[model samples]
Target: MIAKELHDKTPDQLRDELVNLKKEAFNLRFQQATGQLENPARLRTVKRDVARVKTVLNQKAAAAATDA
Candidate 1:
């Protein structure tokens, strides 16, 4: 879940991870809305993780574009 780990992954893998994180985030929001969320703090972590994944993905894309 760290930027260094994400940087080592291929773009496809990063995309997949991003998809999964987004799904988790959606589910967390739903749980919060229903007031059934056990760990409300999880929502914050998931949101940050999503942002981290996005940042890494953008960095990878920029690197590729410059390489071309």
Candidate 2:
């Protein structure tokens, strides 16, 4: 998913996505340990995406705090 799209998601949705991504990352690691992972780069991409979502969430929170 794109950063813009992630930023646009509602808080609940973003949190849910973050949880799912973390689960997937865990599964990917398990697969790697079993030598079943075909694309290890996918793990890196997911980690970056998780960070992007977190950044956007923090940005929104900061903006809200400032406005209040």
Candidate 3:
């Protein structure tokens, strides 16, 4: 997913996406540990996606706080 797409989502949706990404990241790590990971690049992609979601979430929160 891209940051631009994420920016269009509501905070609740972003949170849900974040949760899903984290779960995937966990699974990816487990697979790596077991030497069963098919694509090592996927791990990096997930990690960056997680960061993107988090950055968007933080930006939303900050904007809300400023508005309030």
Candidate 4:
């Protein structure tokens, strides 16, 4: 999630995305454990994506705090 999109999303949607990303992470790990993860880089990509989303969410939260 980019900062622009993250700012546009409602809090509920952000929470949902977080949950879905966590599930994806779990599946990726399972695939790696079974020796079937085709792209080893996928794990890193997803981790970074998760971080990106989290960073955007945090920024939004901080902005909201200041607004109130």
Candidate 5:
């Protein structure tokens, strides 16, 4: 997912996305370890997506803090 898309989502939604991405990352790692991974690049993409989601979430939290 792109940062732009992540920015539009609420914090709860971002948290859910984060959880799913982390799960996918774990599965990808398992596949890699078992030599069953078909797309190695996917793991990298998922990792980056996770980072983007976390970044967006943090930005939202900070904005809320400042507003309050």
Candidate 6:
């Protein structure tokens, strides 16, 4: 997912997306270990997307904290 799109999402939505991505990442790892992975590149993409979501979440949190 793109950072811009992610940034537009509310924190709750981002958390949900993060959970789903982590589940996919875990499944991808399992597939890789069992030699069932079709696209190895997806692992990297998912990892980055996860990081992006995390970064956005942090940014939002920080902004909220400062505003308050």
Query: Which candidate has the top score in TM-score?
Result: 6
Candidate 2 — what's its lDDT? Answer: 0.90
Instruction: Sort all candidates by lDDT, best to worst.
Output: 6, 3, 5, 1, 2, 4
Q: Model 6 — which ten-residue stretch has the worst lDDT?
A: 1-10
What's the distance in Å from true for residue 31, model 5? 0.3
lDDT tens per residue, model 2, 1-68: 88889877888888899899899999999999999999999999989988987888888889989999
lDDT of 6 by residue, 1-68 (tens): 78999889999999999999999999999999999999999999999999999999999999999999
User: Candidate 3, residues 1-68: lDDT per residue as tens digits?
Assistant: 87899999999999999999999999999999999999999999999999999999999999999999
lDDT to native, each model:
0.92, 0.90, 0.96, 0.84, 0.94, 0.97
What residue runs in model 6 are displaced by over 4 Å at the alpha carbon? none
Error of 5 at 25 (Å): 0.2
Backbone clashes under 3 angstroms, per model: 0, 0, 0, 0, 0, 0
Better of 2 and 5 by lDDT: 5
Clashing residue pairs in candidate 2 are none
Output the number of the lDDT-best candidate.
Answer: 6
Better of 2 and 4 by lDDT: 2
Using lDDT as the yardstick, the better of models 3 and 5 is 3
- Model 5 misplaced stretches (Cα beyond 4 Å): none
Candidate 1 root-mean-square deviation in Å: 0.6
lDDT tens readout by residue for model 1, 6-32 = 889999998999999999999999999
- Output the TM-score of candidate 3: 0.97
Candidate 4 deviant stretches above 4 angstroms? none
Models, CA RMSD each: 0.6, 0.9, 0.5, 1.5, 0.5, 0.4
Per-residue lDDT over 3-59 for candidate 5, one digit per residue giving the tens place of the 0 to 100 score: 888888889999999999999999999999999999999999999999899889989
- Residue-level error in angstroms, candidate 6, position 52: 0.1
Q: In terms of TM-score, which candidate is stronger, 4 or 5?
A: 5
Which wins on TM-score, candidate 1 or candidate 5? Answer: 5
Residue 21 error, candidate 4, Å: 0.9
